[model samples]
Target: MDKNIKIADSMLDLIGNIPLVRLNRIGKETGAEILVKPEFLNPSGSIKDRIAKMMIEDAEKSGVLKEGITIVEGTTGNTGTALAFVSAVKGYRFVAYTPKMVSNKSRMSIMLAYGAESEAIDIQDYNKKMGLDADDDSSVHGGHVELLPRQICLDLERQHDDIWWARQFSNPWNVGAHHDWTAKEILEQTDGKIDAFVASVGTGGTILGVARALKAHNPDIMIVGIEPAGKAMMGAPDEYPLIPGISDGIIPQIFNSKIVDRVISIHDSDAIDMAHQLTQKEGIFCGISSGANVLASTMIAKELGQGKRIVTVLPDSRDRYLEVEKYTT
Candidate 1:
């Protein structure tokens, strides 16, 4: 064997080992020692790359995925981008269903670039009319309608001899991916000195993994789950607009409420304001969910006093949200 020839194959090799940066300005401003795990450096420019890899690989291992089968999922942007990236490399067909409120430019561009098919779902007030019932197979929105797939349909597909859904919310693979990879990296980077972890609960996979690992090492470590004030049902909702936080309405099955010590709800405007501040001060351009996490983390730090170490994950890069004013700033 030639020494120069590498054993591993393809761009998939460049998946993990994202950098952890100390946020000096934000830390000082908040009176806490803050560290941010910059996940945008991953292959697909988001933390979802880890879950995408895990879901695909797990499907393969469990014999659910086969040659030429399509990978399908519902996403906003980041997860779809991640799926497209993985699907392109692995030679699988990728299809995504995203809500219309999501930035169209980003969704279309990412799908086109990665050769994935996309369908935009409309964001009607599903709660008031639909009543949490997934039974309405005939819901229509934006003049572009599609039938809602039943649980049986989903199950059949999973059993389908071939296709995989890569459901990020409930999939054990989602939690496992971060628990094995992200958590390990955090421990190594901090030399096992993490006092608390601050993260937004999107799918809840990131915080669950990080908290599990941190608590295992040091049980006293607190895990604070952050959400938009309008959607923070864990705590009292304080009349904030729903923007860039977990407004998906469906609580992920993988999220363990007991594991999370506290939940903080920040206003969307506050998050947007701080996100701009982050770009101006620390030069770290991140998504609004990250801003929510930072806002909550800073609040926690202020409450606990100084000298405490806290880490938060920046879920995606600001590039995805360029059309929004918060990102432009």
Candidate 2:
């Protein structure tokens, strides 16, 4: 964050340099020191803010993005929100394509809140757009939707001449943001005492990027990856991912498997249960993926109990996922 720059100049200025807080309640039983990087404090309310800034600004520097071009991408989650936030403050037009799920409506609302247009691209229709035969099991693969999002970017960019496709999943700037700002902050915040690093694989940008940066500082530092159970990339069954924006059926182009020392799978029940517990005991109201990271951290803490330090990333807060309870008789 550029402190000398006026906040009103651009909210993008307040994107990175978040805080790291010690987990008192969750880590207490495990004995190992557990710390969480509270990325929810970011201006866009998620860690995606870091990548959004870097990607768009990098495009500007490279002359790929201009004043009139529309920034198009596929997401209904934190990445969409961050891009909408950045475009809102930075004088760029943004359009996002998401599956027409009822749950996606809320995320669309958030993008609309920031003046970004949210279009519902029918999943089947987008599959056709990607030249895939929906009926073919080899093509759709019992709902093989891993590439649908990015495919939307590819389609829109080809059709529309003025679209600046922010290919977040494969974008180098995505990794660069975490490597330059996020990893450096962690090193500085922890005074270079980080024993292990843990995070979930979404675009695999965060974990891979931060892992490389941490290892660059100390090769002895342990790197761990958490994925929802059943993600194909991690050699599991292809069940639906409980945490949205965590993973799909395919491995992202930007992810580096070699950067991870350990990869663990978590269940939806365990993640949600831990999320509730975190809210009640630790007072950390984080997103579901954050809970998964916490659950992973707790396991690591238990294994290396006492005297070791473990750090993980809490991707976002709970604001976007909060639901109104249905009243009962």
Candidate 3:
């Protein structure tokens, strides 16, 4: 055998260690020290990469997945793209079920680019088929599609076949991954000095994990959850023009409302406008949800008084939402 040793053999090696950048000019405006966890720096340009890797690795360890298996999950954007990236690297075929409102061209391009497959489901169609009222409980209606994948995957498991279903919304592994990695990184980067943590509620994993970690270090720290106003999904009031980076109507089962100190609801137009401002003024090309979170954080900073340290996540990069921006403009 050769004496030479090799290390860091895969792209997965690049999953974490995202950068932490202090927002200088923005902080000056609010008079609160502001830091942004640039999750877009990840290999897949989103925070979901952390959980995507964890979900896949955990499934493999539990023998729920094996070689040549297919992976499936439900996502609107970032999570699906991250899953596709992971599946491509790990030699597993991947598929995603997204809402019909998601742009087909964008989803297909990203999926194909990462060498994965995807299918967009019409939520209205599923609702009608299941005879669910428009305002009926979402959890009950959410399961209609679950059975489709569960039945197939369960049968494969029974036959000792390899198949993985990454139910991100309900997977404890999803929350655990952030608890272990993302939250830890934030604490380390801030040297345990984070006074306030703000994040938009999607799967709730990010906020739950980060909030728990921050509060453990200092109970005085405030944890704020931001959601889109008027049709917000995470137990918040719902509104129209359902924008990206807000709740998707399905509340994540893992989200812990008690841990959140305050919840701010942002308007879709404001989020879009702020996203534009971020690009124009801050030179940070981020998604609309980042804008929503930033808007919420700024408001919180103003409300809480000056000289506070606030950290938030810039969830995904702007490249994914070019279509939305273009269409709106």
Candidate 4:
């Protein structure tokens, strides 16, 4: 046997450990050495793969999921696609739902390619479809974001006994995955030299989990949380953010405001422009959130000065945003 030649038994084996590429062009301009964790290389195409595998395997061990069970969750795109891919490999059915507004057909198509089902429901129709009484007033999880997908998950859980809800937003495994794998990989890849960290917030799993780990390793590692400029999740306005993956209406149960040293909000136009700039300047084909991360990283870098290694995550590829003209065009 060739000792250097090994093989992965399944796609699940390729969840974590992505490349950390230094930003040459952008870093030079900002006078800060920015490095990116290209999470798009994950088998499912985003950092969601890490938590997806962690959540599913943990559920399997705890008997919360089994052969006859159907996995379900509400996701804008990434997490749903991750679950869809994992469920397919584990021989289970998966159903995902997203608010019609945030829904991306490209991501849903990828999920369908993996043998998963998807639904895009109108936010205005949520009250009726979910069978809620006018007297029963229940707000969505994130303040202004669509609540249909979450309601769908709850409804399915109530209607079917053999259903496993991969609640990535509140699941401890979601945080644990990044704490155990993502953060460690970052630390190892950067050789414990990361002076700053930046990432866009969605379910808060990535920032919370990774921040805790990095802080524990070195309390001085500045952890900055990035959000869509208009959409504020922590101590800010709940206006709808233009970006899809971060700064949604509701704050995630897993997200902790205290762990983040500070939060920076980026405007949609600027974020989209920076994302385009990243691809053109650094040859990094990243999504909207990743661009947001770069925008935040550069801001921090300019403040911190040179010789400091600032790290951030490139959440996924540009596949999901190809339809948005301003984001792509």
The model with the greatest TM-score is 4
Residue-level lDDT of model 3, residues 1-329, one tens digit each, is 01132566787888787767777665466678777877887788888899899999998998878888888776557778899998989999987766554433564587779998766656566657678663332322133333334344445446745556787777887888878888888888788887889998877888998888788889999999987675555556766534564565556689878999888888768877777777787888887788887788788777765788888898887787776644248
- lDDT for each residue of candidate 4 in 1-329, tens digit (9 for 90 to 100): 11233697777877776768998898587677999999998988989999999999999999989999999898767888899888988999998877665557788789899999877766655555556553322222243434657777888888989988888878999999999999999998888898999988888889999999999999999999977655467655544466767745577788889999978888768878888999999998888888889988999999999688899999999877898788867
State the C-alpha lDDT per candidate: 0.73, 0.80, 0.74, 0.82
lDDT of 1 by residue, 211-285 (tens): 888888899988998766653445646565355535433466788878899888777678777778788899988
> Which candidate order results from sorting by lDDT in descending order?
4, 2, 3, 1
Model 4: per-residue Cα lDDT at residue 268: 69
Return the TM-score for each candidate structure: 0.86, 0.90, 0.86, 0.91
- Provide the lDDT at 134 for model 1: 32
Error of 4 at 144 (Å): 4.4
Deviation in angstroms for 98 in model 2? 0.8
lDDT: the better of candidates 1 and 3? 3
- Please give the distance, in angstroms, between residue 226's alpha carbon in candidate 4 and its true position after superposition: 0.9
